[model samples]
Target: MSRRKKRRKQEEEHMDESWLVPYADILTLLLALFIVLFAASSIDAQKFQQIASSFNNVLDGGSSIMEYQAPKQPELESLPIVEEEKKPLEEKSDKQKDKEELEELQRKINKYIKQNKLDDALQTKLTEEGLLVTLQDGALFDSASAKVRAEDAELAREISELLVLNPPRKIIISGHTDNVPINNHEFESNWHLSVMRSVNFMKILLENEKLNPSYFSARGLGEYEPIATNETVEGRAKNRRVEILILPHADLQP
Candidate 1:
């Protein structure tokens, strides 16, 4: 009978928590009611954050996160610049126009040379340096004379007129000579002959009022600079010639 009573007491002590379960359910209901009330209050997140930032700024005496700031720009050195490449097409067009003008001038001179049947004595070439007009010595001079022939002076004038640009260009009239040294016709050496020949030819060219004398320069290359071999007759003849070179770029239009 005592064992039965002890067992009953133990079972009552370990009863399946029915009263505690109702208490737990009441606590949970209170929690849910508090959550519903809090949710109905409707707090604005952005305003709350801004107010928090303001309080932080006041407390710490630092800049506020809510303050306006201009966006940052890239550094000047980091930028990809093209100051030189601006107007690239314009620069190329200017150079091309200058080349075309030179070609046109060469064509005119070549036409003149062909019409006058002076092909053997005169030739025109347009090089990178500019327009080059080469004239044989025999076409403008006698055996040992430096003076240009009277008949050829007209030709020189015609060429001088053709050479006139809108704005004049620098023209170098260079005289070349064969290896044979001269001591006749008032020329003491090949140097004197070459110099005088270039000077006389340039003087005739400058007689045209359209041509500028200051733009013309006379140079003498006395057997020192030869285009052909000095050992052969044909080579010597080829070496004895005059050259007129119109220099580049000084008269370009902007």
Candidate 2:
């Protein structure tokens, strides 16, 4: 009877030791699961991907529940740019051609005056007002006379021919006289003399059918618009004159 009781106590001790092996195994599995959850929460995208790959390789034979995907970026819309166009080259070329033509006309008039030995009685200048042709009063009229000389009528005809060479532009004929007072049967004052002189000269220029009648006009400034002093005879002679102004086409007054 004593041997049987000792045998039963040894069997109970062996049963208690057998239960300890299964409990150790359950604790080890729970610890591994908690460590995996903690790493997934704190790790960056790259490290998480590496850990997922390691877990797959070690535990599930390369298959995994966790997946690593990169975030997508947003796209932007494009817009078109606009620019202004410049002036045409042909317009600039046309302006240059007009300037050259005006310069050539000036040269031709100067050459003609030089050849005829008319430099003393006639003067020419190219200015902002266009070509200016100045003729002394003595060359076209006698003392205190508004009548043009017979020989000087030829000068007016020649000038008209030259004007026909250019395009139609404003032609202004203005007459001026010295400050000396004058009262005669034919004229009352210097103003009357100046007006008659300018009108007569313009009439001769109009005899050419090629010249435009509408483009021509006349003015008489009298003694108030003298170019020189009335204190001397030479100065007074210079002040008494007729001026022909050829204005640019763009500068014509309405």
Candidate 3:
């Protein structure tokens, strides 16, 4: 009977171990919740990669977890944005009208040049930017002289009349020379020749007081701004000429 009682007591002791199992299960559940919370809190992809790499190193028993900041990408500043204002329609139409008028005037000048048989002595060209009137050296003046001939007076008068009848535009008179130097007693060099030529022609053009003197200027480019090469006589002859440039007025109808 005593042995049976002891066996029963041992069985009861074994049943008491079931309470320890519940406590162990509770601890396991708490540990699992803690792990989930830690995982949720540290969710950065770069941090995760570093932690995984660290864990791999630890598993191999190599090194401790290394904490390093991620390399930051450079931030580029935004470029300035500029919005252009559109021109008005009236301004555009006015520009077109000015261009048309300039073309018509160029045609009229060419007709005049042909009618007066001045094409041989002079050349007229309407360029992309302005009109160019070139007068040959012999046609305008004698060799090494800045004096305008009596025969050229008629041509000058015609040009002045045409300009006065038309819209006002600025005029630029320029003189050029060949590569050969001048040794005149009165003039020092080719620079003087070019400058005197421009000045004399300008003086004749401004003979009329009614003409706007402020609209004209004279410049001497010497042999530097030649239109042709100095290698051939013909080229040098072509370079020794005078140019009358008519520029569109900035504040005029254009």
Candidate 4:
């Protein structure tokens, strides 16, 4: 009986330990899976792709589960800079063209005034109102008369021809007079004289077929809007004048 019990104990000691090999293999595979997931979470896209390609090469025996690709940072960043650089240059170019046009018109009128020997009676200036051409009253009309002289009428036609070379804009013909009161046979007061003078001058300008009538206007300021004092003869003469204002184009308004 003792011999039989020893045999049974020997058999129990040798009980199968082969099942533990497969269990160890399963645990190792689980650890490898966890390591791959942790590595994927910590790496950038480039490094992750490289690691994936290497793993696929090693595990799949030359067959690949991942395709290598370059990062897309440069393409996304360069597109907007190219598109945003062109707008301000275009706007500046348009403004420059308009400025050049205004300067050219001023030069032409000044040249005309100098060549015709009318510089003493006519003056040209660039003002906020536009190109202002001022003419003394005695140059265009006789005392208390609204009729333009024959030579001055020819000058008006020349000016109108030059003006029509530009785009259509406002042309204001304004008349001013001295402070001396006048009630003559033809005019009731200074107001009537001023208004008639402006109308007649504008009429001569419109005789040029190239000038558009709709763009011209006339204003009579009488003795109220004087440029000089009324206390002296020279000042009074300076105050009696006519002004022609040529406005800038509509798109160039400040």
Best by TM-score: 4
lDDT for each residue of candidate 1 in 14-122, tens digit (9 for 90 to 100): 7855446455445544544454345345535654454455445534646533352322333567757676776677677877887898898889988898898989999
TM-score list, all predictions: 0.65, 0.62, 0.61, 0.69
For residue 113, model 1's alpha carbon misses the true position, in angstroms, by 1.2
lDDT of 4 by residue, 1-254 (tens): 69999999888777765345565445544644554676665567766666566555645555333343332333344545554578667657876776677678889888998898888888888876688889899999999899999977987788778778566888899988998999978998888888889999999989988888999999999999888899999999988888898887766675
Whole-model lDDT, model 4 = 0.79
Comparing candidate 2 with candidate 3, which one achieves the higher TM-score? 2
The lDDT of each candidate is 0.79, 0.79, 0.75, 0.79
Candidate 2's clash total is: 0
Q: Candidate 3's C-alpha lDDT?
A: 0.75
Residue 33 lDDT in model 3?
Answer: 46
Tens-place lDDT digits, model 2, residues 1-254:
69889999999999989767555445545544655677665567866666556555535434332333322333566754333223345545665666566678878888989999899988888777778889999989988888889999999899888888556878899999998888999989999999999999999999999998899999888998887889999999999999998876672322
Query: In model 3, which regions exceed 4 Å deviation?
Result: 1-92, 252-254
